[model samples]
Target: MLTRAQVDENDTVLITGASGGAESAAIQLAKARGARVLAVAGESKHESELDAGAQEVPIRGCPLQDQLGDNGVDVVIDLAGGPNWPELLNV
Candidate 1:
């Protein structure tokens, strides 16, 4: 999906709910493909998400929203599929 979305080197990719196995695998895959991946999850799961090859972004207080500004994201691998869904649209 990342490749289909044209996620290349230096492109930003966001994958919500990184605590799960599928999400973690997606994070690793995105990283291996050279995309800068942001794994969104709870603060407690940040370390595990990072270990899966993604930069951490807490769902509660997502700094990425401000960091990405109006440019938004190149691609999103949404595993959470909840309220955070709309929020991920901006980053």
Candidate 2:
């Protein structure tokens, strides 16, 4: 997934469903590659995501676009593709 996204140094990568097993590994990989990792998960899993190497975790109940602001992430790994999938593109 990182290869397909062309993740690189200084890039900002966002991972949805970030508490999953694969997503946890993805966070570490993104960080190891020198990219900043932003995780999207429930509040309960925020700490775990951080422990997995994510630099930031969006607050639950807030829109992703609002939290990300104008300068959004360079890559998005959407592990939880569902009703909110379309919203990811906006961010």
lDDT per residue (tens digit) for residues 11-37 in model 1: 878887778899989988888889888
The models' CA-based lDDT, in order, is: 0.77, 0.87
Q: List TM-scores for all candidates, in order.
A: 0.81, 0.91
lDDT of 2 by residue, 1-91 (tens): 8888778897999888898898899899999889988999889998998899998999655799988888787888888888887788777
Residue 30 in model 1: lDDT: 89
Badly placed stretches (over 4 Å) of model 1 are 61-64, 67-71
Best by lDDT: 2
Error of 2 at 21 (Å): 0.9
**Backbone clashes in model 2, listed as residue pairs:** none
Candidate 1, 54: how far from true, in Å?
0.9
Query: Which candidate ranks first by TM-score, i.e. highest?
Result: 2
